[model samples]
Target chain A: MDPDTAIGGGRDRFPSTEHSLLEAAAGGLAPEALERVAALYWKPVYRFIRLKFHKDNEDAKDLTQGFFSSALERDFFARFDPSKASFRTYLRMAVERFAWNAHAAGKCRKRGGDVAFEPVGEDAALTESPEEAFDREWRRQLFRLALRDLRKLCESAGREVEWRVLEAYDLAEDARPSYAAVGEQLGIPETSVTNYLARARRTLRKLVQDRMRGVTSGERELREEMRRVWK
Target chain B: MEVNSDPADLSDSVVDHLRQVAGLPDLSGTRYELEGEIGRGGMGVVYQARDRQLERRVALKVVEAALAGEAALIARLEHPAIVPIYEAGTLPDGRAFYAMKRVTGVRLDRYAGAGRPVAERLRVIRRVGEALAFAHSRGAIHRDLKPQNVMVGEFGEVYVMDWGVEAVGGTPGFRAPEARLDQRSDIYALGALLQFVLPAPAPAALSAIARKAMSAEAGCRYGDVEEMLADIGRFEDGLAVTAWREPPMHRVARFWSRNALLLWLLTAYAAVKLGIFFWPYR
Candidate 1:
């Protein structure tokens, strides 16, 4: 828990929120918005199935896809009442309810009949509760989304210097380079390394907050989520 | 530069590092070691950082380089109430920052909320007024003066924090309708700040001063912070203020309140003299 990880991204909207996702579901379940939700949430859903339902990797993967397809067809997300609970909590409960009913009925949906998404890797250290696992995976997938967006941001906006600074300083695969060394490597002033890194980090923070906003129902929920996860 | 749609497989440590980097203002190249955040505002976040070379704790206002003019602004005017900037530089993360003496105390809003006597609150607000006056004298307008921006220390010292030198727009409630930042806008903020610090049953004279300072029209407000402070001075001294036309009864009451000790002594003396004069026809 880094002390610096205090919740602070004010007003940065990248994509949308869970409210819009529900609205999209109501409006014939817009495929694009649903796909974004699936991409962002598939890992969390799969992890929840694996940890909570005691499913093997293949079963969890199949159930994960089935859950999304089933929820999509059944209009599960549209029933979210923001006042009752957070979208995250609502989602977790929905998954649990769906899994229990399916397991009791001795039913298995045909595989490969749903939205395709990246599978959650072997997180064998499931010493924590299922809820905690789902939340952790949610945060991890959030970072991945932000990282993916950052890559696109740098490319589209020609922010290569900022990206390079972030890579050399923070995302260094090996030993992190010194500012002077990075400056020499990039053929820019030593000071510019930090300047660019600052820009990149600011952008990254906004993206992360934007992702947080996308999952939350409103500004208040987004702030609560930021505090819950970051702190 | 070669662009990839995805980041190279991010490890757990990478995510951890990203979390720190996203929230923390990296100060690797600078002497200040960030302890924790003090607070944040529109301009930037203020962190309680230790100046390694000086071996003392200072507040580092870590803001974007574009919004880092506060250092130079404070540097120009050396006033006791204005938080003094010690050094200014760019953090390793490239955000421009300025290190200043970290005055430990409650914000004016919190301090006011503590239910201090109106006179005590008035004294602190007067100091805040003086600070704004000094800045205005130096041809600089605070453009953002509110209870939250003023710091009241334990030793009864007040420092106006968060100059917001680079910020064009002030906070909503305090800011005047005037779009431009000027001395009058600062006066408007000062009035709002004055109103915030005052207790609910604020005295008529003092409330009048705040009301004049916070007048909707720019010209209707104080010509300068000095004028507002002068009216505040008059209110404190039990003299007639320019802002309010005090009725004779309220004026007499104010006079009595301000000179209670002297008036009490005079009344006692007059009673003794009258007792001696009327003493059995002596």
Candidate 2:
């Protein structure tokens, strides 16, 4: 089916020169339209979540559904801007922020902190049979596959200077060590830790953006994705 | 040293290096007789070739002009369902090359469409599903899941052909309606495959299920591969040989979209109000 007539048709199209789609999305297109637009980009968001969260498919699906629901919330839409960055950048930034918030809250919950969990959104109205649904989940594992490939690529290039730091801390936030501690672990001075992290962060960010290239468009969008990771 | 990365660059220098390495012949006695190209796509080109050392035929796939970085990623994988990469090095032309056990079979499409018996076709589809399920369980997602890429050997071995197109399951048209294409998207595509292979007597209920499974919207599909697999098991166990077109709930969701809105609004109001009152005190 052509995506145009569905809610996505009205939401946004690619190579978004200006942020007209962002504007429409901000203004509240119909729920169907939101779904249409979300459909176009959900894969990237979900992949990022899978890589960041270390959660399996069931959890990934819940988080992903939650992400879209969060995006549609009144406050989220109200705060969005087109001129600031591309949609891909905006979406990735949103995911990073959301994950940080969610992780922080989960930690709070573990501490006997009574943080209320909002019922963000309803379940997706999926129609495929059990067999078909199985196929989709299998396909979803591509992110891990891609990550594995990326790890090997880096190793072969002998670009080990900072990738170790990235691999260690990027997957799980809790395991992150202070710069002094990292320097001790790697047997480098504390000052060199900062340099390692800076270089590592840049390389990690570049690796992700390069893989993501061609799947989207334009140099600006790629830069936007780079900006998004730290967001 | 850090990989020299210019932000605008997609050129995979790592792959380029590997291609250079391949030129040196890591396999002391093996000379690869490059033959005519059998297939080509965005990632690499597959050529029918002779592995002189093995004294047998094999396929050598040289990395495309792009995707030079994939040299490292593809080289590590070892699975029955995947096309195995035996060695990774560079070709004389400064392109990365990998050799795998060349496959001989018909594309799934040939055996999947009309004129085939329903039972046999469904069996083939099930094998495809199992192979994909196996891969996912091992933490791999074949983002490019389509009939053309699926190879069905003479003995019915189903090999899912590509991973070069893979990323974190976000690219559309590859996985289920949910984000980060999971096992469920493979199931949905398999469902689509069933539609391609089976006759008209197949149920509309199945199609609705397939449509939802393959939904462009990630949030509208099944949660994972296992759930879908369970449903398929129930389906096959019952094997509604008669092929019923419409199930009752399918009718309800269609006619009820108008009412679906009303119900959603009533629920949303309650949720938001309650959410506001119970909002986290931060």
Candidate 3:
């Protein structure tokens, strides 16, 4: 068997875990999968926030914990169906939403009074010299993670139609084939392919929102996360 | 080919080896032939190596996978201002490794001492500014736009290396003093470079502009890189008084010599007239 075909290689796994978690969540084992993936992913997500925002330890930790707690309560993992998007992408979108809330809250607090939070240490080890390209790449990576999860989730759910339309139009590196060609391949009209892609995008957006439910608490938080993740 | 569900194949061995190598315990891999150390920074050490398959010289920079992540950030980037990242993947030990074209050039700080004349130095400075502007347009802010980060090749090609501390809109290095590290950060650095490269007076004016751009109060500074570039133009044209003013050291020497020459000429004329009067008395 081609081992490379698996999700993440041995010792470092995600794809299988995500699948099992999703299935478990769907089949009443969701509680267990939810806890496991959350436990595994929380710190990584927190670290991302810490590094990207250079937030203090407390704030980073709080956001990290809050994101997972919200996810559990909101059924983020339980709602996973490859029919919508990939889990990795789902997590990133969740984190982005979390960041926006934290940022907006921080701004609001600053307006009211002195926000007393220590800065991340000056000695924080930097891998690259500070350059704008570095930051853009970081943002792009987050985008890619969400996109990857979306692609994988759809493929897994046997939603080959929606998945293929998105894959050909949005994800694939090459220029998209004409709608007619795509239609011929998918056994749908060229117009249908375009229409399908549009619908698929909306589905992807909803999937992201669904995932956010597990990561955020209320309607306000959900809306904020949705905006952040979608953006 | 049959698909394997085993996780082993999903992760690359190269990724693991690199992770271990970067983490400091040591590296023992035959797949990657580490030739020699090229450079070292906060992130990782760069090695010049041979790609056994392609048989081409490539620079390998090993970083911590956990810190670096699944996709190599450098690999996805392309810019004239940035060193091109060619490929990235994880080693066996989960170390993240990135490869790029080997650049042969002197750091910007060393460029000035390379015996290049003033015009060449200014050109290098301008080129660096242009590169910074390009990256800024992509919403990338180079917080550390110092001389050392800029490199100049033998052919006068300039490249900006190290985007490690970039602030997107506002990243860590974008201190309140610089306010927004965007293109203005590069502009400040360019202004500093102009001070060093351009003739004396030009530096002062350029420095003033730089100081304004880098002002802690963001409102008082040039809004963007375009504005900064326009200021550089003003300096180059000698319109910037602080930058183009004659050095005080030259002023004193020139003033003394001119005054002495004038006095000597006037004395000579007076002596000739007196001599004419004396000749009449005789």
Model 2 ranges off by over 4 Å: A1-231, B1-30, B64-79, B92-94, B165-188, B239-282
Task: Put down candidate 3 lDDT per residue, B21-115, tens digits, no spaces.
Answer: 22231223424566777765434557887777688888777654443742244444466656787677665445567777778888877777746
Ranking by lDDT: 1, 3, 2
lDDT (tens digit, per residue) of candidate 1 on A143-186:
77776678678879998878877877777756667899888888
Q: In order, what fnat does every candidate score?
A: 0.27, 0.00, 0.00
Q: After superposition, how far is residue A66 of candidate 3 from its true place, in Å?
A: 36
- Go through the candidates in order and give each one's DockQ: 0.14, 0.01, 0.03
Q: Model 2 over residues B159-232: C-alpha lDDT tens digits?
A: 77766433333334444455455555666666566566667776554555566556566556566655555555
Best by lDDT: 1
Per-residue error for A178 in candidate 2, Å, reads 66
Candidate 3, residue A210: how far the Cα is off, in Å: 33
Model 3 TM-score relative to the real fold: 0.40
* TM-score of chain B in each prediction: 0.84, 0.63, 0.63
Pick by lDDT: 2 or 3, better one:
3
Alpha-carbon RMSD, candidate 2: 27.4
Clashes of each: 0, 44, 50
